[model samples]
Each structure stands twice: as structure tokens, then as C-alpha cells.
Target: MEKNSQAVFPNHQHSRGKAWRWTLWSVLLAAAVLIGVLQILVARAGPILKGRVVETLKTRFDSKVELDRLQVSILQGLNVTGGGLRIYPPDDVMAAGAKAPLISVDAFEFHAGLLGLVFKPMHVGAVHVRGLAIHIPPRKMRQQGAAKPRHLGKVKIEVDEIVCDDSQLVIGTDKPDKDPKLFELKHIVLRDVGPNAPWPYDAVLTNAVPKGDIHAAGSFGPWNTESPGDSSVMGDYRFDHADLNTIKGIGGILHSTGHFEGQLDRIAVQGTADVPDFSLDTANHPMYLKTEFSAVVDGTSGDTYLQPVQARLGESDFTCSGAVVNVKGKGHIIDLDVDVPAARIQDFLQLSVKTEPAVMSGVITTKTKLHIRPGPESVTQKLSLKGGFVLKRIHFTNPEVEDKVDMLSLRAEGNPKDAKPGAPDVHSLMTGQFEMSGGKLNFSNLNYTLPGASVALAGVYSLDGQQFEFTGKVRTQAKLSQMVASKWKSLLLKPVDPFFHKDGAGAVIPVKISGTKSAPKFGLNLGGKKPDQASR
Candidate 1:
């Protein structure tokens, strides 16, 4: 009986071991099946999620979408990778002649938790985009109608951050022939991206026109899907090392800081700019220039209207208002109304003239229209001015010129003996209407006044201070006979003094001024002869 019981126990143990093996096999089979199912789901998720991506972008942009490749992986959270994506503008916008896609990306990647993917609103930790390009349509092509309500449906997406290291933005104009404005972005970062919500952003970009680097940070969008150009934007920017030589006629190293707010199409900006070495190519003399300005800019067309600009050059102060407009084929045209209530003529001469120690000094007031046309010409050649100016307490720097003026005033006052030598400098007044072009100033109705004489003249003065030609009549209180120091000559000229006297003056004489500023010659105009010929 003992032997039989022992044998039964062994059989029972064997049966138990066999049962354990069978249970282990069943568990392994179930696990295999589950893994197969998961693999299949992951394989299919790529196409399904690809479709969702397309649908989301289409709804968000209100545009047609195209995608080249998509991949999905669930081993490490949920990873998605895509390439060759392009989003086109609305049909009507395309019909309006916009051929470029609204947005395009060469590659992109994002990651999310598997649980998050199944939730109502997907949460993505981060997204990285490469080779992105965004093109903004012209104002007329953008939808002017009321915006449509956004519906993200059951599956919405929220991203914590998005980064693009290389990107470009192009802004188009309504005119067919006009060139678009281009901005090259070196790096950009967007934070807390969600539907119909403003996204905070930081960016570094290069401006094409003035060729400068700009760093900006602010909030942009809550995007206007219907009219991207109408997207709201507010930011502060710092522009550095802007090379103004990109413009044909001017040269400067500019730095600016400003704040701007408004829709992309129309932005209001307040800023201050400093040019430590501002100069005209023709003059080649650098001057410190600074300005505080308020302006309105049309981003689409790159047109700016200056509400007002308060500027200082050296010690001189002025104000100007104008528009800088971009033409189709031609570059920008600058039209300004400039007013200088009080300025030093010496400051102007230092800026414009090549010679050191300006030829004259005085207080001047002027009102002028300044026009600059874009071309290959130098700034002096392209600049045109129409203005009127008044100069008070004028004093010539040259001793010879000052002495001559002093002598003339003494003689005119019938004090010829007082004009001997080393007399006190006399002040003068000058007023004129002037038009400047081709590096020359033409003066009309020019009036000059001193103690006892007044002269009216019309003439031209070259900018180089190389030539001066003037003809006019000088009226004085002294008789012509009294103008001579020689007693015999004075008596001989006394008989004909009545013939030279007129216009309520003791003597009226035709006078001419010619030669250079450094060596001006003053003479009597006996006939219509050249000033050189009339010089005594």
C-alpha cells in the first residue's frame, strides 16, 4: 500500500508541472497577439494622423494643403516627422494673380505623449521646423470680408513651443510691376501656440532695403486666416549696423530702436535713429545726425509717411514731414517739406562745402521743399530744392572781403576818410529766393543791405565755391563824385553826377561781382560786359 501511494504522488507532481507549462504558453501567446495588434495600430496611425494634419492645416489657413511624407513612432511617446509641406492661398487670392504658396516647409517634427494623442485636445511638447517660407499677399488680394468663426472640432492641437532656425518672409504689393519686400529670418521662436490665441515670439531678421539686422520680441497673431496681412502685431525692435550705402546716393551707419503696433498692413511706429557718420557721397564729409520720428508704414508696399521728424545736424535743428514711396521700377522717392526756423549758416557750409572754415557766418531762416529721386547719380546730383532764405548779421570770414565791404559802407555814408584801414567789421543783411539743382544755386530778387547802401541782384553761385556772377544796381546816400578820394577826379566827375543819380538816391551805380568766393572782384558795370572786363 505504501509503494502505490508514493507512485501516485510522483504522477500528481508531474501533472502539476505539465499544467504550469501549459499556462505559461497561453500567457506568451496572448502577449504575442497583443503586440501584433499594437504594431498594426502604429503602422496605420501614420496615414490617419497624416490626414488629420492636412485637415487641420486646411481649416486653420483656409487654404489648400499638400504634404509629401509623414512618419509616426510610438516607442518613445508619440513622435511625428513630415517633409515637403505646402499651403496655398484661397482660390480667389490665387485668381487675383498670387502664384506663390502662402506657406511652405521642407521638414518638420513634433512629439506628444501617447495618452495626449487620444485626448480631445492634443498637447505637443515642442515642434521644430526647417526651411520655412511665408508669403503675405497684397492688401487688395486679401479677403476684406468679415472673418469666419473658427471651429477646431473635437481634435484640437496646442503646442508649447515651435522653433525655426531658417526662414523667410515676403510681402507683396498690389502693383504688378513692383518688387516684393523680403525679410530673411535667421532664427525665430513661438511660444504657447493655440488656435485663435496670440503667440509670443522672438525673432532675428535682416532687412533687405537698408540691409540691417533687427532683433524683435513681442506677441503676434490670433491669426487672421481670411486676411493674413490684417494680423495684429505689436513689438519692440532694435536695429543695428544698418548700412545706408545700399541707397545709391547716401552713406551712413544707422542704429535705431523703436516700438510698433497695429495690423501688418498698416503699422504705426515711433522711433529714434542715430547716424554717427552721416554723409552725402558728393560731399564726403561726415556729420553727426540724429532724429526722433513718428511714422505710418504700409508693410505690404513698403511705403512710409512721416508724420513729423525732428532732426539735429551738428548744432542746427530742423523739422520735416514727407513720404518715402516705393515706385514700380524706380526705387524710393523722398519728398519732404523742410523748415529751419533758425540755424547757423556755418553749420550748413560745414556739411556741404569741402573747404574748412566756412566763407561766411550768420543766422539764417529758411523754408524749402526737398526732393530726392533714386538713381545711380550722387546725392548732390539727385537732390533738388526750392526755397527762400533770410540771412541776418552776415560776416565774411575773409579779411579782404570784409575790408572791402567796410570801405564800401563808409563811402556810401559819405565818410570816405573813415574807411582808411583796420576799421570795425560791419554787418550786412541778405534775402533771396533760390532754386538749387545740378550742384548750383540760382538766386533771384536778391537784396543786400548795409548801413548806408542797398543793392538788388540776381546771380548764380556754384556749390564748389569756385565761381560767382552777379549784376545789379547799388544805391547809396553819397554822390558819385564823393565816392573818389582824388580831389581832381572827384571834381571832374561832379559834372556828370546828376546823370548817375536816380530812384531817390544821391547816386545809383551799376555793379558786378565775379570770380571765386576766396577772391571775389567788385567793379562798376559800364556796359553789358563781363564782370572781369568791368573790374578796375
Candidate 2:
């Protein structure tokens, strides 16, 4: 065949090769045109796509989180966020449907859209954030229950980077009882976290740092019914300067740090604080408690309210463990088991001694429970503790002592007055039995003021809270002595040894107070046939 004819017909292999080349060129040209169209379409559709996505997210999330600027790239399949975004993981992941609350980030850039980019994929860029606010829910917000059900889903908003200056943190959520007049935080600089990146934290809230009215930090996460103990968060908190209005009964320069972790509502903790100077001041300021201390508590789901607690006071170095329980709607118990090698009753008797003294300290080893029943009537008003204490030394200062023999071991009890079966019903509860034993009581050396100072030999004595009922004394034969003042000497009917004799100067001879617990009576026996005694 001629060249021209063969070319037209594509002779054999030449024809096959020519057809293959034409097919390849057509495919290339079509791909190039399609890509060009796709690029233009993406540019044109970006704004609309962004608006639709924004509306969709906004409608789904409600006002829990507000996303600032949103943009979408269809061609590259990418999205970005320029504002607030928060993520609240679901509480019960097992449940077919569960919801969590999310906080909004101030502003941030996000890269996420190539999830389906298989063969030739893409990389989403990083995000940015500014001015973030985090919240810790209390008893209030939990009860809200989505405020009439606008939608359903966990609170989740993803972001990239964050930058903050003056931010606030809410300790607990709002309650109908009115936000605690005391819990508020202002001016805080928090840390930053990420997904594929290490939790880079340069932030530090040390002593007196991150100054705010209140400070709270701990390992926090939403609840997981399947695994309650799977969380591994550490607690760390520092509240620099904050108002103490919420603790209506107490106030101060709140300096505290502690270990914390666990779910939001119920948390576990171990921490300490140094209240340099604190108070409950109205016009000026009324001081409440001042000391250094540490504490720990265990919490769980449902019954996880911080009930039983343990605390250690540094100044007195006393350790106390107890549970704060509300009983039968009338009594509030601060039930405790106390062990104070050196128990100083400063905070316990705040009103009695505005300024405390170191000598007022004592070593107290006892198992005591304090129950407080408050009532509008006298019958219901009582503070009771029934237990035994072995006192090392409890001082009621005697100025006459040039030697400062200011130590005495006293086993004393303060039982409530009496309770009547048919008596008018009141919120008051009786103070149970109080007792102290096995202690050395060294009163002031009385040598200078009168004669030789008197000191009681080691002994155990039991008194009826306010008076002496039946005196139980333990002693070695060592004689006890006392000094007599000239004025008081005239009052003694006879001169005798005060420690052993019933008729000696300054001798408080053993007397019995008796009667029904309801109406106690008192009696005295001084070498007499009978002495009238009844319950007081």
C-alpha cells in the first residue's frame, strides 16, 4: 500500500500505536480542563460552604460554644477556625446517645478536611486561639438538663493554638441557691494542649501566683460509666489572692495548693494551704482563722460528695479526720476521730481567745465525736463530744508561777444537761460523756506568792462536765502540797494537810453530784452523817 493510504488506514502496528497516542492525549487534556473547573468551583463555593457549615454547627451546639470565623476549601477538602471552640466529651460513651458540654475557644486556626484523601492526600494547617474561658460545673448546672432540650450530642469543638491574658475560671456551676457569694476567679493565664502534640505547658501557678479571688486546678475529665477508675490525672492548684465571701463563716488571704484529679462533679484531692492572715470582715475585716495546713479527701460517683475528710494544721500540727453529715434534718454532725500530739484549741475556741498563746497547747490522744444540733429553742442547742483523752499538758496559766509550772493533765468531761422524754421537743442534742485520764498535772510553783508551791501527784479524776460527781483519783503515796494566802487562810475552819485531809485550806474535798440525768443534784460529805445532794 502507498504511504498516504497506509497512514490513513493506520497500517497494522502504526495504526494501533497512533490510536493509543490519541487516546492518551485526550485523557490528559480532559483531566487538565476538569481540574481547572474544579479549582474555580472551589473558589466560588468556599463562602457559601463556610456559611452552611457555620449554621449547621451553631444550630447543633446551641450557645455553649461560639465559633468565630469559619472557612472551607472544597478542592483541598480543608477547614479552619479563627475563634472560640471547646470540646466536651460524652459522659456515657456506651449509651446510644449522650451529651457533654463544650466551652468555646477565644479564636484559633484549625486544619481538618482531608480525612478521605486516600491516594494523593493533603495536610491540614494549624490553628490559633485567644482569650479562653473554662468552667467547672457544680451542683447547679448539672440539674439544668439541657434547658428544655434544644439538640443532642456531646460538646466538642476542636482548635489549634491558644493565647490568653486576663481570663476567669468558674469553680462550680450556677445553682438555684444563688451563686455562692464567695466563689469567683479573675485574671488567670492557663496552659495549652493539643491532639498529636505533647501537652506543652510553660504555665505555672505557684505560691501567690496567678493571683485571683479563687484558684482551682486538678485532673479533670467527663464521667465514664464503663470505667470509673481509668482516669490518670494529677491535681495541682494555686490560688493567690481571692475574696472569701462564699465561706461566710471564714475569710482570709487564700494561699493554697493541692493535688487533684478525676471527673468533674466528684473529685479526689490531697493538698495544703497557708492562710497567712485571713478574716470575716464586714466594714473593715473580722479575722477568722490564720494557720498553715494540708488536707485530703476521697470522692466517688453519685455518693461522691466530699463527705469524710482529713486535715492537718501546721501551727498546732494536729491531725483530724471526720465526716460532715446532716442528720435527720435537725442535726449536723462534725463527727471525728482526732489525734493531736499537740492539740492547741485556738481555732476551736476562736471567740474566747482572740489572741492565742503557745502555752495553751497540749498533747491529746483521744477518740472523740462532736455532734451539733441547732434549734431555735434551748433544748435543741448543744455541742457534744463523748470520748476519753489522755492529756500531756493543758495549761490554764497561773501568773504566780515564777517557774512557769504551767502544765496539767486533766481528764474532764462535759455531758449535756438532761433530756426529758416528755420534754418539749427541741433541736438540741446532749453533749455525751467526756473523760481524761493517766496524765501528770503540774500546776504553777507557788513558793513566792504564799508558801511552797503545790503540785498534784499524777492522778486520774472524773468530773461531771460542769461539776464533780464521783472523783476517781489514781496516785502514788507522794504527798501533794499547796501554798496558802493569808487572806484565804482565815476561811479555813481548821489547819490541815490540803492534799489528803478533807478539812484543809484551799482543799476542794471530793463531793458527789447526783440525781436523775434530767435534774442532777449535788451533795457534800465532811465527816458528817449525811449531806443533801441532787442533780443540778
Candidate 3:
């Protein structure tokens, strides 16, 4: 009986051990089968996701899509890596001679967990893109069509974030000869990316023309597949340390802040720009310049039309409206209509002239057309102006010049006693039609008026205040004999007074002004010819 009990215990122990082994084998087999299924799913998902990506972009952009390589791995999670992806515009929408791809990417990578991948909208933690480039065609060249709505069928993609460290955006022009505008993006980040939804983005890019860094944050549209220029955009931007010297003719360190909204083709922008040391290269004299402007910008062609720009230079204020357009070979051409209600002439002279002190000081009003041609030439050489100006209470900065003018006024009034060395300063009025080119101002129908005399002149003056040539007729109210203090000299001049009298004036004399602003020469001109003509 004891032997039978021991054997039964051994048999029970063996049965328990067998049960444990069978359970272990079943668990191992289930795990192996699950791993095999996961492996198969990963393998199948690689091709399916690759095709989905291509199809999604093609349908979304209405363009041809290409993918060089796509790889999927599930080491810790489902990961995707793609290289050499490109999207080309559809034939119906592509511009005539346009061959560049609309978008291109060197490589991109993203990761998703297994549970995230099984969902209807796949949630990607982040997408890192390298060497992404976007090229937008000209507005005029793009054909109009209804955009096709985008759909992802059963599975959709949602990204938590997308980061691009280096990217580029090229905007093409309708004119074939013109160069395209380029923006180099240093960093870009888009959050909450989804289909047909506005994407919030923050970007830092370099402005090509001004050579500046721009930091912007905004929301951009899902997309405009039919006409990319019609894509809606709104943003706030800050441009810093923009070097205006890149334009060749001007120099300044500019800072600006602005807000913009509307479509890509036509954006409304309002901004203020400040340049603490703005200067023309010709003068090299810096001045503080500030402007508040409202403009419409054509993002496609890089053209800007100023509805109005209010500007302040030093203490003077002015308003202008114009267009800054991109020319074929000349780069940007700035054409503006400038109006100054009332400003100090010295402010203008100090900014444009090389002289340390302005040659004249007065209140000046002007209406002018200002045109600046882009070139390697200096600002003075490239600037052209057609205008009319009126000067009131004008006084020459030099006391000697003012004294000469006072003496002239005194002599013209037949007050010879007051024409001596200690005469008081006299203010004058000047009005003229002027044209400026090549750093020189030419005046026509120039009228200069004092208390007792008026002069009508035609002249040219160099901007450097180094050259002056003028011819005019001075009309005075007093007779020639009355201009002399001595009785004998008056008697001697009485015979010649009749010869000098003309045009209902007691005396009319042909006069000429020559030499520099510092030491002007005033003389009687019996022969009306320029100084160059006299030299010849």
C-alpha cells in the first residue's frame, strides 16, 4: 500500500509538469504568430503608404508626383523615410515655357505608433523635411479653372508638427526676360497640419533684394491647386537689419514691422519703416528717415504699388504715391509722385547735396515726379526729377550773399545810401520750374522777387554747389541816374538812363550770375550768353 501511494504522487507531479509545458508552448506559438502578422503588416504598409503619399499629393495639387524611394520600418514604432520627392504642375495649368517643378524635397521622415497607424486619421508625431523648395508660377500665365477638392479616401494623415530647417520659395514673373524673385528660408515650422485646414506657421527667411532677415508668423490656406496665386494668406512680419546698400545707389540699415492679408497675387500691407542712418551714396550724409505706408503687393511678380506713403526726413514731411516694379534687366524701378505742402528747403539740400551746410534756408513747396532707375550708378546719377517749386522767405545761408542781395534791393529802390556795407539782410521769393538729372538742376522761368526789383532767369546749378550759370533781366523801379549817390555821377548817368529803360520800367538791366554758391559773381550782361558760351 505504501509503494502504490508514492507512485500516484509521482504520476500527479508528472501530469502537472506536462500541463505547464503545454501552456508554455501555446503562448510561444501565439507570440510568434503575432510577430509574423506585424511583420507582414509592416511590409504591406510600406508599399501602400508610398502609393498613398504619391496619390495624395497628385490629387491635392492636381500635378504629377514622383517618389524615388520610400522605406518603412517598425523598430520601436512605425517609421517612414522618403527621398527625392517632386511635384510638377499639371499641363493645363502650367505656363508656356515653364518646366520647373512646383515642389521638390530631398528627403522627409516621420514616425507613428502602431495604435496611431491603425486609426482613421493617422497621427504623426512630427515630420522633418530637408531641402524643401516651392516654386510658384506667375499669375498672368496661370490658366483659370475650378480647383478639385482633396480627399484621402478611408485613411487620412494629421501631423502634430512639420519642421524644415532650410527651404526656398521662388516666385516667377510673367515677363520671360525678368528674373524670378527668390526667398531663402532659414527655418520653418508648421503646427497642426491637416487636410483642407489653415496651417499655423512660423518662418524666418531672407529677403533677396534688400538682403534682410524676416521673421513671420501666420496662417496659410490649405492650398489653391488650380491657381496657386489665389491662395489666401495673412501674417504679421518683422524685417530687421535690412541693408539698403544692396541696391547699389542708397545706404541704410532698415527695420520694419507690418501686417498683411489677402491672396498671394494681391496682398494688402500696412507698415512702418525706420532708418536711423539713411543716406544717398552720392551725398554720404546720413539722415533719419521714417515712413508709414499702405501698399498692395503682387507676390507673383514682386511688384508693389503704394496707395500712399507718408514720410519724414529730418524735420520735413512729405507724401508720395507710386509703384516699385521689377524691370527685365534693370531690377526695380521706383516711380513716384511726390508732394510737399510746406517743408524746409535746407532739409532736402542737406540730404541730397554734398555740402556740409545747405546753401539756402527757406520754406519750400513742391510738386514733383521722382524716378529712380536701378543700376550700378550713384543715387545722384540715377535719380531724375521734374518739378515746380516755390520758395518763400528765402535766405542764403552765407551772410555775404544775403548782404549782396540786400545791396541789390537797396540800389534798385534808388536808395544808394543804404546799399553800403552795413545794410540789413533781405528775404526774397523764388519760383521756378526745375528738371533734375545727372546731379544737376536746370531751372526755367525762374522768378526772383525782392521789395523793389524782380528778376526772370534761366539757369543750371550743380548739386555740389560748385557750379552756377544764369542769365536774366532785372527790372527795377528806379531810374539809372537815381541809382547813384553823387550828383555829378547822376548827371553822367542821365544820358544812358534812356538806353537802359524798357518794358514799362524805369530801368531794365541784363544780368548774369556765375561761380560757386560760396562766392557768387553778379555782373551786367550786355551779351546774353552762358558762361560756357562766353568761354568758347
lDDT of each structure?
Answer: 0.84, 0.37, 0.84
**Global CA lDDT of candidate 3, please?**
0.84
TM-score of each: 0.86, 0.43, 0.89
Q: Give the TM-score of candidate 3.
A: 0.89
For residues 95-136, could you state the per-residue lDDT of candidate 1 as single tens digits?
877788999999999988877646746778788999999998
Residue-by-residue lDDT tens digits, candidate 2, 1-536:
69787687646778799899999999999999988976765565445434443544454434433344555565445555554455442232212232333344566444556442222222333444455444444433343333344454332333333334334333332333223111122333223332223332223332221235444443332222122223244557665665444333344566666666554343565555555445422112333343333333222211212323344433444445555443333433444565545455443333222222322344445556544443332211233454644444343222322122211101010111221122221211111135332111111111111121222221122111222233222121222232222335534634454445433323333333333222334344344321122212
Give candidate 2 regions above 4 Å deviation: 1-160, 163-198, 201-232, 242-246, 258-268, 278-315, 323-336, 343-352, 355-367, 370-388, 392-395, 398-536
> How well is each residue in 445-520 modelled by candidate 3, as lDDT tens digits?
7999997899998888888777788888999989889888899999999999999899889899999999876677
Error in Å for residue 259 of model 2: 4.3
lDDT of 1 at 479: 90
Predicted candidate 1: what Cα RMSD to the true structure? 4.3
